[model samples]
Target chain A: MNIHEYQAKALFEKFGIAVPKGAAAKFPEEFDTALSQLPEGTTVVKSQIHAGGRGKGTFKSGFKGGVKLCKSKAEAKEVAGKMLGETLVTVQTGPAGRKVQTVYFTTASSIKKEYYLAILLDRATSRPVIVASTEGGVEIEKVAHETPEKIFKVFIDPAYGLADYQVRELVFKLGLNAAEQKAASKLIRGLYTLFWETDASMVEINPLITTTTDGVEALDAKVSFDDNSLYRHPEIVALRDLNEEDPKEVEASKHALSYIALDGNIACLVNGAGLAMSTMDIIKHFGGNPANFLDVGGGASREQVVAAFKIILTDPKVKGILVNIFGGIMDCNIIANGIVDAVKEVGLKLPLVVRLEGNNVVAGKETLAKSGLTITSGDSMADAAQKIVKLVA
Target chain B: MAIFVHEKTKILVQGITGSFGARHAQLSLDYGTLVVAGVTPGKGGQFFEHNGHKVPIFNSVADAAVATGATVSAIFVPPPFAADAILECSDAGLDLAVAITEGIPIRDMVRVKRAMQGKKTRLVGPNCPGLVTPGTGPKSSGGCRIGISPGYIHQKGHVGVVSRSGTLTYEAVWQLTSKGIGQSTCVGIGGDPVNGTSHLDVIKAFNDDPDTHGIIMIGEIGGTAEVEAAKWIKANVKKPVAGFIAGATAPAGRRMGHAGAIVGGTEDTAAAKIAAFKAAGIEVAVTPSDMADALIRAAKAQNVKLS
Candidate 1:
């Protein structure tokens, strides 16, 4: 689960991280009022979206007509109206621009220090890593490529909490003064507290900047929580914006299944977590776009398979579904019944490609073939992948 | 006979009265595994029946292990109490412990890992489906997941398979069984970073077993455990081996289910491990169906036959 930038900042501000005050507006008219609310100076206007690459689209296109110095309120309103609802090209959307639903306007601050900060899962260590960098305002990935030494990654001890000594050292490495150092420590500590309390998988603040002797504030924030841990956190659940997510993904999560909506036409559902991923990859390799990754786990029953098919059919973009089951302990016949039941109940009409292996594979193929649902069975994975790819193509 | 667990390994359930715990414990005891004791703090003195015998209940791991001489512990505590339960089990000097609970804090596992080190104790999972010594011990907890796969899928043979994926292990065992291969033992090492032992740990035990012959390895994309084991297999293990990896192209951006099952982690993606295995001249299966053929080919290629 991921939260928007403003929501994360609100949490940080509540924890006493001094952040610049700003208002979120959806239109250029709201933008003008938002700018007027800030101190009469060069104000920074940022696009608010769940994904990155706002500047590459709307902000540059909408806000760039002319710099109208508004000493009065009237000038701001007219300028705001033009920018409202206007689509602009962002790096995210390519030449096609993403719609700007909201614009954040705030008084720009003097940055004496800039650093990168994020809490991400380090899979090798299976630990949450607190990565801080002296170089701020730029994407940390670039720093990783150009100057890897600048990034200092500290693996947080989830049991003991973030070590205070490590906090002090991180502050020192960032080259902060006494006052900034204290504030940074408080921010990092508070961030950790928020991370734990909310069960966040990641909390990122790019360009956590220190103003000239004033205080440190988060320039941008991104928070991601463990979906499995969401049951323990009601507050995080209330903050979830259904509008910011893929509708198919939202529906899939309800079934306790992991679904990543892709730009593919093949709706692939496979049993076993590992096999599901490979199924998707094979679909892609066979010149078909995979619409999702659905894992029915190892012991997927007829019911689970039905639910998986329903989830895939929900996506209109799906051209067909490829059902790949490598029969382990999970009976392939049970899974075939699920596929038959789901198709039967939902009146599903998409082409189905199935490649089954192991126990009762023959019986499973026979069951599906007799189900009378445009079913295609392959003796091998390559054959299955090729059939689906051709069907969609 | 499987190492670490067999018919004689006395078992104890840490949360015997819980729903999933008691139910699975019943299933396990029925399967012929000797379950001597159960432990649930404050619920001590209560007893449960397994394998036609009434087992004594205790309040702590030490009490259970000591009183019953239990060597293996199965923990069904919820996430919040998981670390403490494992620690207590470790302190009891048990030889092996399985923590079937999920969402354990990394710090807790680290401490548990450190404390269990140099001792006779080994921990299986902080968040996983509990281990099963099939046909030897009772499948203890309802959630500990015995026979989540079909019981008949295993042929009861000489191949010892170790994997980080719990379900995949069931899948591999099923595949091996269909090909007329019975497993000496199947181990899910758990995908948690702080969880006990590695692929190498189980492989070492399998290598020492005279009954165990060829091995089949199934790994997901994440961590270096599989890669590291491939290297070890290349150097040591006098057995024919073949491998398969799931999530071959798990989008570079998207992650797998377990926080630990990511294939795209530091120097160990599924591609990387497969590369290492192929470089070591190991036959890698392209799909689950191919696993049987690959393992068969590896055996023939090595001119090795299981007795």
Candidate 2:
């Protein structure tokens, strides 16, 4: 659901929020043309990736800085050349890093001061909260932890939308001048509109800078849309970059499965989200590391089970698989049959342990027993987890 | 003696004409619940006949409530119209509205919640398994089965259960039932960030219920609702409470299937929630399997007779 900085800035412009003129190039050949679109000034070359900490990131080609301030257009093009098609390793992007499929070039502005601003749901209030701070261009969490008072929050009433007073309060708290306050207020309102209209989960602008002309702008934009609301906004969904996501995860989503790959050997397949999470926790508690967390949802049909099995097998790190189902509404027999068919289809050699309970569990267990597949059945979740961990070990 | 529902509570299905709604409606009827009516907008004046029960279908919640005297509604409407369905129940002044539909937009829920601030109806979930109060009959068939939870897994007893996840709640209930323990009522508050009820709300209800002797609360990594409930339990409630927090192995910023089950701030992490539970004197289950045992330990320490 996350969009790149360039995409976010494009969205910001649509909402009348000021962002530095920028252009993106997917190839080195397009880099020169992209740089040409920017005004002749110190240009900022940013590697396009979904993760944060891009400025501090390093490319795999021994190139320094995923984001760099180039002195000229030629320099910006050179930096873009170095970034495009190279893998960027940021703090958020793990060791394997994200490959830079696109590079953005923006005109670097002279900043009088930097400020932090964001709009997201405050779960406690069930309301959208505008978080602003005087300290910007750095991690807001660090600021909130260290200074605390430097950070200010304004919770918006969804019924009334963002109030003028709330914006003024934020502007005043950030110690903006009259000119800057007017621009900040307008920018904040526009940003909130973008957030609300587009069904954004979060809209963050780190280092929201005020130029020497007292004009406020979003220097770095990070926006993520609410996945559930994506159906209403096809335009927003079109901005999604499939290259940034793991292929296994993408494949699982296509099959309506929720899967997040991890570094362990024991793969977990559970019926519900909370159960899937706890399945991973129990595996770890029993001295086994979980390789992934996969939820086949409430009604685990045979095809979904087969698809899940194929996805799990794709992970060579996974030495064993554990299927945990509390079949409240789901029929346990269907799940058992799916497992039997999946094992036969995939030629699965990994240790498989299943703990099936609730609704027609007797038939489910009988089916598993007669499968003649090397699948182990445990009496309980604990028993199943223990069995899988031991077999893998 | 259940907190929200019982044997005589009249239930209605909102999207009864739909496959999902009809399927669970049949299951509820099979479980011997008094399914009084169905609401499918245009399918009014029709009867949802299943297994010798001919439940009337109405055009609106108001019409359905007036005609059938149904006090609670189980909503299985699609996400787009689910909010309107809940608002309808609120307008009709129903006692409870359990939303079983998932994938509702946060914006819709936020507005629905705001609009229902002073309303009479209590909303349970938009992506939940619903609530169940066990009956005394074979496989607990006569109880009030509201949503998609399997009624046979429950047993009529004193312990109250509340959870965010459907299967995890079942896991705890099954474990308790396996140990010859029975539950007074089990409630799933749903896994959305903007749900109708919170852990604190259910915990308070369970604490106030005279029949509910002990409680099992299963929460995942998310909002401060669980922590707030634990703190309240520490101050006011004398009833033994056992707590289990999932997503201990979950990474930060990853949504674990459930829209609400994501680690955002430090306070919402599994470690943080577990610490809060321990600090509030709630027995924290080390693993999901130990949920029932953890409650038993808490009950033993407090000298509570949970059935």
Among these predicted structures, which one has the highest TM-score?
Answer: 2
TM-score of B chain for each model?
0.90, 0.99
**Model 1 lDDT at residue B87:** 84
**How would you encode candidate 1's per-residue C-alpha lDDT over B11-113 as one tens digit per residue?**
8887888876786677566555667899989978989875566988998888887798988888888877888898887788888888877667654565566
Cα lDDT of model 2 overall?
0.94
Chain A superposition TM-score, candidate 1: 0.85
* Deviation (Å) of A237 in candidate 1: 2.2
Best DockQ among the predictions, by candidate number: 2
Alpha carbon lDDT of each predicted model: 0.71, 0.94
Q: At residue A15, give the lDDT of candidate 1.
A: 69
True lDDT of residue A301, candidate 1: 70
TM-score to native of every candidate shown: 0.84, 0.99
Best by lDDT: 2
